[model samples]
Target: MTSDQYIIQRKVNIVELGATLGNISDACRKLGVSRQHYYDIKQALIEDGIEGLLEKSRRSPRIGNRVAPEIEQRVLDYALEFPTHGQTRVANELKRKGVILSAGGIRSIWLRHSIEKKSLRLKRLERWAAENTNVLTEAQVQALETAKEEKEAHGEIETHHPGFLLGQDTYYVGYIKGVGKIYQQTGIDTFSNVGFAKLYNDKTALTAADFLNDKVLPFFDGFGLSLLRTLTDRGTEYCGKPENHPYQLFMHLNDIEHTKTKVRHPQTNGCTEKLNQTIQEEFYAVSFRKTLYTSLEQLQTDLDAFMDRYNRERTNQGRHCRGRTPMETFIDGIELYQKLVHKGELMH
Candidate 1:
């Protein structure tokens, strides 16, 4: 029962026992309720019978609110027409029809008698496990065997030095309440947990080009690196003929050596992909508690603050600079970069 119901039940029981004992104070002290409350319950019971002393139902007395049957059917029909439209949009549509209802009220009515889709996107393993009795196909078995043998020979991740590799990928930042869906293009340096994100309207070549030119170039330039090997997914944004692709042009301009992950294989860029989860949990989830930004400029400002906190304050898990933040590690890396540059050493 709800707390309200529980309190009323306790008060009613106290009054009943107090009447039997012929002392209100004795029952009030034992029950830890005021004598006024005990007497109130006794008077309620005497006037309206025992039914009045019992807890009343919290469910609204009104039937399905004041919304007419015809209006509710119209809301359902509109929802059916556009499956992607959420409760807020449905409420707005209903308001245009001269029917006023709060979003929560509309959602309650919509959910009461409708089939709803789950919000989460199912992973491949979950889908495969549900469909097949034996989860792994023969092709998957062969690929796993090959990967295991290679890993056994090569050992684990090379966490020894800097400038070894850099990984890149795009992650969707789910649907924002006011702004539509957007992708967060991200990059992670292998040696350090230092990463950056640039929001994109879509996963197009032009947007991908902006990430390469505006975000990636300035970072590499700050560290005085020109020719580093970059890992990326073979999506249309990053691959295709150089003549037709913008990422090709940008990479060439910046003298960046490029490598692509195998088709249908995400594990190749697993480090950066895992970093995407960190971005979502640490930045997006935390920022929602404060103001939610609608414009791109405000969103970028919030992202910059989040990135600063992530790199300067947060600690890495298993790498060498365990206690130090990514920013501190990055500073240490800069010292190494300057020393190399001074010693007349070629660096990538």
Candidate 2:
């Protein structure tokens, strides 16, 4: 039973015990309640029935600190209009319109309405716009259109085969005891989950180009697979005017298509970003204190060994290669494609 129901039942039992015992003091002593309290319960039951025995809310009716309905509606409207904005930004926008609210208060409102996440809020707004286009203001209609366009522009990339798309990025591995700050150039095939990494003392265009040429290109070439495209962030190491950047020039010379991610979206190169994180957690973090390396050459050798084990033995739980190691997934995909080609079921 609920606490309120239990409390009411106990009060009724105490009253009943008083009536049966024929002594108020005895009943009060047995029930551990004062005689006056028993009388109060009896009077409440007589006046208002069972509900009178239940506990009532202790909170005041006039909650002065609560947000006004109109202000709350304004907050909701502002959030729907710019679903990508954070709570602070939304609150600031509301304040500019003379609707002052703390960021926490705005977030609380968002939480109550289940619109805290940008994606959910956008979906809600889009649904509302679609259902009530005749009633929406011009500005609201325009905002909905803009949100749709933004969502379309940032859609996920789809890769059909192992060598179709590769993501490359650089990571700064911290300084070692004997070595200065080291950087790692990492690349990963998005479809196969196969990864390549090389450590460098610096993050230069030349280093990036050399890593692609020596490590990544050679490995794929050994498998008789051609890397069609490379994706990287718009960092100076990977992108610039085609005539000036070493990395861009290298891709051009090798007949590989070079694609740079949108200005602020590092997630476009998420595969290599994840590879950098894995190397840091699995290799660098574990090996830094366990092994002593007096030179960069020694560290590079260890890194290469770790990469070999990672590609051959570590089972990738990625969607494309659920239970297979990277090398296994790569080879299997290539063989499948070749078989389809030989049977005249797939085009070149």
Candidate 1, residues 1-348: lDDT per residue as tens digits? Answer: 977678667766897788888888998888888888877787887888766776668785567455788877776665443333456655655665577877786676656655343121112222333465444344333322232111111112443234546677877765554565667888877667677788876887777778767876677677766436678888888888997688888777767777887786767777787677666544553343234457656777888787776677655653655656666776677667567668867345
In model 1, the runs with Cα more than 4 Å from the true position are: 1-164, 337-348
Candidate 2, residue 171: lDDT: 76
Extract clashing residue pairs from model 2.
none
Per-candidate RMSD, Å:
16.1, 19.6
Q: For all candidates, what are the clash counts? A: 0, 0
Each candidate's TM vs. the true structure?
0.51, 0.53
Model 1: worst 10 consecutive residues (lDDT sum): 147-156
lDDT of 2 by residue, 139-199 (tens): 3333223321111122346676777788888877665545666778889888888889888
TM-score result, candidate 1 = 0.51
Off by over 4 Å in 2: 1-156, 339-348
